[model samples]
Every structure is written in structure tokens, then in C-alpha cells.
Target: MSQIIDTSSRAHLLDLFLGLRPDTLSLWGKMEPQQMVEHLIDQVQYTNGKKIPFLEFSEEEAKLAKQKNIYTDLKIPKNVIFGTLPDQLIYPDLPSAIKQLMTELDDFDLYFRNPETTAIHGAFGPMNYKEWIIWHSKHFTHHLSQFGLIAMT
Candidate 1:
């Protein structure tokens, strides 16, 4: 299982972001390159304890998440509803967007290193630090694959 909190996987993700071109097209989702980066930053904000989730999950949903281990899945299914990115965080260019997301990812990594706080995920319910790591790794890979940076096998 590749983990975004792991140094190697982290570097791989960062390199992929850095390699993104402005005109890159998504293989599935509707987001442009900068929009994808901003969307990731929004997700990382939740992981970093900077945002509060409005959605709540039932115990059944949480238990199902654990049982299914959905985060460990290799692909994010097409046409899934992932929601929208906020207007404020969208960058004017791809490099700026990637830089912002990279910073957020670094902050997330630091928080995971000495996790002192807990946050609720909108769908997955309560997740510990390790679960967050696994989720981010898979989520990052899912989006990276959107731009063909990570090949789905």
C-alpha cells in the first residue's frame, strides 16, 4: 500500500504535480489542471484540521468504510460525486496551484508525523492519522491518474 505520508510516495506525488502542464486534460473528471490542484488542497485542508465537515455519517456507514477498506482501492470510480472546489483557492496558473497544494500536503505530512488532532471525514466518518494517510495516498493517486501521471494497473 502506497502512503502519501511516506517519503517516497510523497515525493512521487509532488513530482507528478510539478510535471503537470497547463493544458492537461482529465481522463475522466471535469477539472482542469489548476482546478484539480485546488480540489486536492481543499481535501488536504480537511485532513489538516483546517476545515469542518458539514456532512455526517451514520455508524453503519463508518463501519462499512472500515469493512470495505475503500481507501485502499486502486481506482476512484468514474462519475462519482466528489463535490466542487471553492472559488477562493483556485489559482491563476498551474504552477501556483501546484505550489499551494504542495504546501498543504507538506503541512498534512507534518500533522501526520505528530498527530495531535482528529477530524471527521464527510463520508468515511472518523479517521485516525493512519487512515487519513491511506486515504490521501489513494485519493492522490486517483487524481494523478486523471492527468495520466499514474497509470492504473
Candidate 2:
């Protein structure tokens, strides 16, 4: 499954984005392909240890969320809205948007080299590098499935 965090699977995850085009239609939601890519960039940006924590989950709730989301195979339900995406494109093209997302994802390597580094996920509170990887795996899966780039498992 693409949910695995190994290098090969992560490469495959990025490859999924490479297949996206500007005209690609989502099965649900208002986000265009580039907007979705930009949305993903927003999601990844928080994991670089820069964003302030405004956790949506309480201490106990975060534990339950991580247990179900990070440690298990629970899927993000279809059409689950975090917020409506803007129609404006961040990058002029889908490729450019995806490239920026890739750059942001790679920055985690440097950010987590300290091993003590941690980041806040709005729903999962503070998480470590490995936790973020698993969170990202499922996150990419959810978005990719929305565009039918990958099957919903």
C-alpha cells in the first residue's frame, strides 16, 4: 500500500502528483488540480516545525486520533472538508505547484535531523517525524483518490 513510509513508496506518492494536469477533475469538492496541489502544500508546510500549534484535538483526543489515524489503516472519509479551497492558483501550473509541494515535503529531512524535532498537526496535536510521515501517507491517498489518480482503498 502507498501508506507505507519507505523511500520507494514516498517516491511513488510524488509520482502520483506528476500525473495531475490542470484540467483534471476532482470527484468531489471545488478545488482545481493546482488548487488541490497548493492545498497539499499548505498541509505539508506545518510539518517543517515552523507553524504555531493551534491544536484542534485535546491531549486525550490527540492520542485517540493518532492511534486511529497514524497507527492504523483508517481512511479519511470522502468529501471531508477542512475548508473550501480558493479558486486562485498558487503556481501558474500544476507542475509548478507539485514541485513546491515536493520541496516542502523534502524539507522535513533537515527539520527532523535533530530527532527531537516535533510539529503540530491541527487534529493530532504535536507529532514526531514518523507520525507525520504516516499522516502524510494517508493524506496524499485521500487527495489522490479524490481525483481518481489512485483507487480509494
TM-score of each: 0.82, 0.88
Tens digit of per-residue lDDT, candidate 1, span 1-153: 332323236666677788789798889867778877888888889877678764467878876875466544545565466556555545778788877777887887666676556567777777777777767767777777778876765
- For 2-27, candidate 2 gives per-residue lDDT tens digits of 44333226587677888888899999
Give candidate 1 misplaced runs (Cα > 4 Å). 1-8, 70-74, 85-89, 113-116
Which predicted model would earn the best lDDT? 2
**What is the clash tally of candidate 1?**
0
Error of 2 at 140 (Å): 0.2
Highest-scoring model, TM-score: 2
lDDT of each: 0.71, 0.78
Q: How does residue 69 of candidate 2 score in lDDT?
A: 86
Off by over 4 Å in 2: 1-10
Q: How much lDDT does candidate 2 score?
A: 0.78
